[model samples]
Target: MRLENVSVRYHRRGPWVLRQADAEVGPGEVAVVLGRNGAGKSTLLQVTAGVLRPTRGRVVDRPRHVGWVPERFPADQPFTVAYYLTAMARVAGLSAAEADRAVDEWTSRLGIAGFRRVRLADLSKGTAQKVGLAQAMLRPPGLLVLDEPWEGLDAAARDLVPLVVDEVLAAGGRVLVSDHRNETVRLPGARRWTVAEGTVTETGPDEPEDVAVVEVAVPAARVAGTVARLRAAGHQVLRVRAAGRARDGATPGVGPRPPAADDTALPDEVAR
Candidate 1:
């Protein structure tokens, strides 16, 4: 999808929140929107998600099914989690049975199964965030737009953010997310869009710095969790290989060992 010379303002004579913001994100790619509070990050995301109309310019080639998760989910609704998700699924072009199945599937996947029958207004902030995420994924869209997806989520839920992005990319879908908490380090190879003073500019990933690579020996069952932790901590994991085996050797049940303590290593920030 592409936004050409996009500009937005609340009123005709009001100041523009975004000006001539030209940006594009294609299938199988993820773009991160970065900016300080009140810097038009949410406005850009709204425009990208087709939730808000731009005062000038236009969006082209946007997908028909666009999944948008706003910064603040409206949890004051009277519908239960299951009911709300099912209704949204239908809106996303699912049949009655399909919508029921989708609601069950996503509620389970997002760890909100117990709250399926609970009213949205009664759920906690984190649980409400989970519902927000689950609804967006009930029917995968060609373009997925998230605004501060990590906000109000627990640690485990926060870790799921990258996995969701991976799922979208694997399905050849495009993703555009805005974040200020630096919690998106796990989204490897994501293009960066920095917004400042109602202007947006794209920046490619930084060049890899000279740093030592460390390999930790974790049990096979624990590898996924360990990798997620490392990535969340701003560490760039080089690769994962079987223990005591060559890089191209057959996979083993156990993980590889860590580097010797004497090895020179740079801080995780440098690697990021």
Candidate 2:
């Protein structure tokens, strides 16, 4: 997808949110948008997702099926979750039976199946966010645009974000995402796009940083949770080992040890 000379403003005389912004993301690629608050990140994403029209320029070759999840899901509607999802599925071109099946599949996968009968107005922010995610994914979209997808999500749901991105990319679809909490670490190799001063700039993938490895010993049961937390916090987990084997100094189930404690070593940061 490509945006050519795209610009946006709420009012004719108001300041421009994006001006002459040109960006592109090809199939099977992911772009992570970075910016400060009110830096036009969401505006650029809206234009890219086909949710809003550029006031002056135009977007070309946007996919027919676009999955857009805004920062906050509109959860104050009166409809029940199941009914809303079913309606959205139909809007996305699914047949009645297919809509039912899709609703069942996504709600189950996102762990909101039990709330199917609950009214949207009654669901919590996190659960409502899941519903937004589920609706966007009722069909495998050709372009997936997510704005702060990790907001209001629990650990399990947060872990699923990467899996969802992978699924879209694996299917040759493009992904555009904006994040403030540094959750993009889970999405390795995504292109970086920064929006500032009504301009959009694209950068290559992150350069390799000189990071020191820190070995963290955790109980067997907590190992998985620790690794997940580290990755989620943008820390690279060099390796994880079974505590039993590490106690015996066995090499089989052990990960590579750090080189040496140096200035870059951050044991305190990793141990938590």
Candidate 3:
């Protein structure tokens, strides 16, 4: 999938959020989009996902199919989790029975079974986020645009989300995700794009330093093991960082912190 000189304007006579933003994400490749908070990262993902139209340029999808999950899901309805997912499955071209089965399988797979019968409005933010993932996987469209996909998940769920993404790519699916997490950098051979000042640049090995931060959530007991895995995989270990203050004697999951975006930069994880 590629965008040709794309630009998006939210209002008349206003500046475009993205300007002359060209990008290409290929099959078997994942590209990480980066910027500081409120820095148009999410907007770029929207344009790629076809949810937003470019004001001046065009987006072309080689496969002609795309799956999109936004920063916040549109689930303010009086529907059960199963109901909403089943509806999305139908939209994805699944038969009623097939959608039911998919919902069953995914809810179980994502460990969201307990919330299956609950209404979406009553669910917590993390549970809602899991539903977003389920919808993306339910169809496995050619291109996936996920924005902060792991925003509200617990540590176990966050770890499992990457596994789902790996499965999507192994099956020849392409994904574009922007999150406040470093795990995005660890995907093998995934491309990187940085957006700022209404322009986007495809970051290669030699790009100048901007901000370097990676977010991971890991239990204290598993820090050493996780670090070993990342190092073996050849990622710059930016430290086994954790977010939020921990209670007395409790293991904290690693959280995201800035890291040099250069692929060759080795960052020591700020182990908590």
Clashes of each: 0, 0, 21
User: What TM-score do all the candidates reach, one by one?
Assistant: 0.81, 0.85, 0.75
Model 1 RMSD vs true structure: 6.8
Write the number of the candidate with greater lDDT, choosing between 2 and 3: 2
Q: Taking the tens digit of each residue's C-alpha lDDT, what string does model 2 give over 198-230?
A: 999988777655556456666678888888778
Identify the runs in model 2 with alpha carbons over 4 angstroms from their true place: 207-215, 220-229, 236-272
**What lDDT does candidate 2 reach at residue 202?**
89
lDDT string, candidate 3, 101-153, tens digits:
88899899888999988999988888888888888878767887889887887
Of the candidates shown, which would achieve the greatest TM-score relative to the real structure? 2
Best candidate, lDDT-wise? 2
Given candidate 2, what's the lDDT at residue 199? Answer: 95
* CA lDDT, candidate 3, residue 127: 84
